[model samples]
Target: MSVMRVAGLSGLILSRALAMTVDFTQTESIKKGAGEAAWNMVRYYTGNNTGDTPGNLPDPYYWWEAGAMFGALIDYWVFTGDDSYNTITFQAMQHQVGDNDDYMPQNQTRSLGNDDQGFWLMAAMTAAENNFTNPASNQAQWLALAQAGFNEYVSRWDDADDTCGGGLRWQIYTFNNGYNYKNSIANGCFFNIAARLARYTGNTTYSDWAEKIFSWERGVNFINTDWQVLDGAGNAGTENCTQINGALFTYNAGIFLYGAAHMYNLTSSDTWKQRVTGLATSITTTFFKDGIMWEPPCEATACDTDQQAFKGHLARWMALTAKLADFTYDEFMPLLKSSGVAAAEQCSGSPTSDWKGHSGTACGFSWLKNSTWDGNYGVGEQMNAMSVIMTQLLSEAAAPYTSTTGGSSVGNANAGSNTNSDNLDPAPITTGDRIGAGILTTTIIASLLASVVLMIKE
Candidate 1:
């Protein structure tokens, strides 16, 4: 079936949950499976898997990868409040920083790349600020590392253009071509990380950088008329429509929207607020259909090389749109829950198969034929999906606008209660705290097992 059909089927399957609890347990098992799949991919990177796996490499000390997983772990901790998640995530951040005074060299830092590192830095800063008082020294260290990384990134990439215009290039080539392309994704990261740092540090410089970059992006690259992102220079006038390579990148738009919203929170800038509203409207009206956003129209889709890659992008975009639109859990939850249910129903019994590059067991389900990149799912996609879902839940529970009003007296009383509850110190996770974690753990394991069995049967 087409992803659209699958998405439609999902709505039917999950209609009942629209008015019910938005707790993790109430979500579909497949959605949870997808979340576990993301975490498992990180587990592989962290050398936390069971077995003395022969191919296992030492956990990455690189900043970008570490930062991505750190962000994912923070999302996990926030959603499940599992202390182990916090502990493991903390260790991973420290690992990236290395031993005292033997810190990883600047040359090795990945923030210079202008992609994953910026996003990861934002995530790390968020975690550090949240947990600042609990583990003062560790929090300080993470924050310091992130700040240093940001400073280095700015020095290397910030050009002479306005803050928005002169952000980092998509990738830094050591080769002498100086062919750095200004990309939407990288600039989006700059906006997000800089704004986040500003909030945490009360530094106007970071906020200044964020505001400039965001304005530049909207005014320059983003096609306000159609909401399409333009490829730079040579590809000028052309909308980016390729996956991973900046055409219709959902994550790029997602990060930009999120950053714009957060910046509005920091400065209450009408311009930033309008940017968020405009982008959100553009995304909803342009990309979404039958509650699923189609993946970018890539050469792969045209060549029929692999449809799964497209599917991956579609899922990511839907998750992102749901969050940025600030769709109440009631309105947005069905998109994922339904998709999982449809997958489960369609592949009830089939031969279990594996996609070539994707880790973990695969199911025999095939949504698109003649797709070359079919079996090669990665940790990145899963992590993106998990983060989207968790963020959506948190966004809903917190009622994002509550903060905007400067007080709890607003339209959402439940959210006000939640805001108060969140302000209370999170109790240390112990035997008593295990109940919630146990539920999440059980749900994840059970979902994975079910998916494997379903794939095998199919």
Candidate 2:
């Protein structure tokens, strides 16, 4: 309806005619709505073709958030069949796979945590599972990149040495502040990737790792019997991870749930299915209110840049879980449907729009407020909205590919640094990190020898 046609229309008729933001019943509507929301999200991205960075956003956004953004973009291409953002997504993933082939990029060394690196692992895994075009044969293959990150994480697994039985530390670098904590998102990411890799490669080792993580979380009480996914706990020797943080975040729940769903997919065992049932139910109980998805913990005004992005992850993995576990489709779809419309309704905000009659397209954080347009905007908000809306197309979308089901990305079992041994562990290492102890010892010995020779000459 154009401005001219707006004239003389009855209020009720006009209201009924206009879809709030999207109509899930129509595939075209879902695609159009998701595409518009994604385009608006891209407007915030400055790393596409300019001199900034191929996959990075501007200052306010962090590197890992960029990983999450590209992950969403991968899903966008999958759901809507749009290739517009593929180049940048590919460039970003490739550029950030630091020298060791793990996602521990040098530029983000100080800030890179296991969780931060895990987000990018998800993007690569998403590409492989969805069959997003593989990179040039010379570049890191998607499956291998995911495997590399997984390998590095496995190397860093806090086994006999660290706290809370076994889990990835929140931060990889010992100098970082959170090194003393073991968080669910970091370990959950490892578990999620492990499950998917197991399915994608027919590798039983990854499945074993996945099962171990699930057991550790439950055994350590990071995941309670009710399946409530808490945030983190203190490091091993210090707190023994005896005190769980108990804070709830959608991403944490989604991450664990996603991995569990894949576990059920891979093993048709009753044990995995029961675990999936518990986690999926927990997703709805903890994150959703009567079928509408919202971040109960942070959405009520305290969502930092990172927290604002959590709901989108929940929405995305929920749809994915539904696809992988057919039994979950019925329970998950209602949440997806309700949240998609709610999210889309808040997307009707832009600077140019007049409050009176015009509306523009920029997503907001408060989807529960719906149509009221929460007046907040950023990459997180946009990704959240887009993730919810695009997934509404799952009814028409194909199921994700498994190893025997058309997956084409090559794999390298030893992709990341396998350096962490009996007493050595490293990650998000600085640019100069070569072969660790050998290079450092060699340099030290050479200096000592040169000093002795100089003293003899003197």
Candidate 3:
């Protein structure tokens, strides 16, 4: 059958499949996809034989990819009650901690460009603490490694003179590249990792550092008067290929969302909630079109570039958006599935096709032949996107329901109150809930609008 015909059939099948059952057994593919994606990422990062050419080894060995994958694995295990995903994640952490040779000897003590390593370390630590029951589970070892890596990252910060305000410098280089400009995405990741570490270890120092960096980024470089993030404060007018001037990025936005969500979880502060909601709303309004999100230009001229090329970033932001929006499994599931499937389709015949690529590995896929960008295949973008998607999916699947006091409930406080027909709030969604409900809602609304137009025509 034609691709369009297949897509149509898949859409129909997805629409009808989850209407009746609320159980997780009904949506095992999402869980499995997340697990598989995480495993693929770990394999890719470890340079395992996936029958694909390896992309350029990421500086610091792409620990963020590993961290995010493990994070997703934890989320998957929580939702599906599957121990295997958790087991693999634990093993990956052990590999990182026990095998000191994972990093090159020259790169080991150098923390200058180690932003991703810290982020991934924290992710592994969180997973180990949450899942591992035995002392040999190495939860403590992973946490220590993450904490040490964080300390090394902290040392790279120039406290005396806040050049990029108070945020950490972009990287540590032996010979000065003279570029001290802090990147939004990197700082955002640092803030997120620091904040989570603070909460995990009961240490206020890490949290304070996270807040300081977040404040620095918000106050100095990115945040506009309306609190929207600009790409950066550096090189305002001149066009730089590496620096995308004044444009907001979906990945950067996702990092901020992750930070904000963690902040909200830690403090229960309304400020964090408002910021997250505003950013999320801005993202939905500005970049999202036809259920796909697009990346903002790295430069003014690139603004008109084909939006389809940025699907990886969109997928990442979508997962973050779902988390912040508190979307139920039923609501966001189809979108997740569609996004994953679409992205996977893009890399289907390429060398990186073995894994989801977008979320499971560190590289970029070759753009289609007719596209503007180079078709050079890599897995970094795909792996980054997949990690977030998987993490969100698993988290939703594993969330526990709490009984609502003085309410007719199935012991799941998040389960929508069936009686409040006038209340237009979508069902309460936790991180572990499936995205099916949100997708269903979107479908139903679209169908109704179509029917209304048909009636008017008749």
List the candidate 3 regions with Cα displacement exceeding 4 Å.
1-26, 32-92, 95-112, 132-140, 159-162, 174-179, 233-244, 298-341, 344-347, 350-378, 381-396, 399-458
lDDT of each: 0.43, 0.76, 0.43
Candidate number with greatest lDDT: 2
lDDT of 1 by residue, 160-223 (tens): 3322335455544322121234567667666776766665555676787777776666565543
Order the candidate numbers by TM-score, best to worst: 2, 1, 3
Please estimate how well model 2 matches the true structure, expressed as its whole-model Cα lDDT: 0.76
User: Between 2 and 3, whose TM-score is larger?
Assistant: 2
Judged by lDDT relative to the true structure, which candidate is superior, 2 or 3?
2
lDDT of 1 at 323: 48
Local lDDT at 409 for model 1: 14
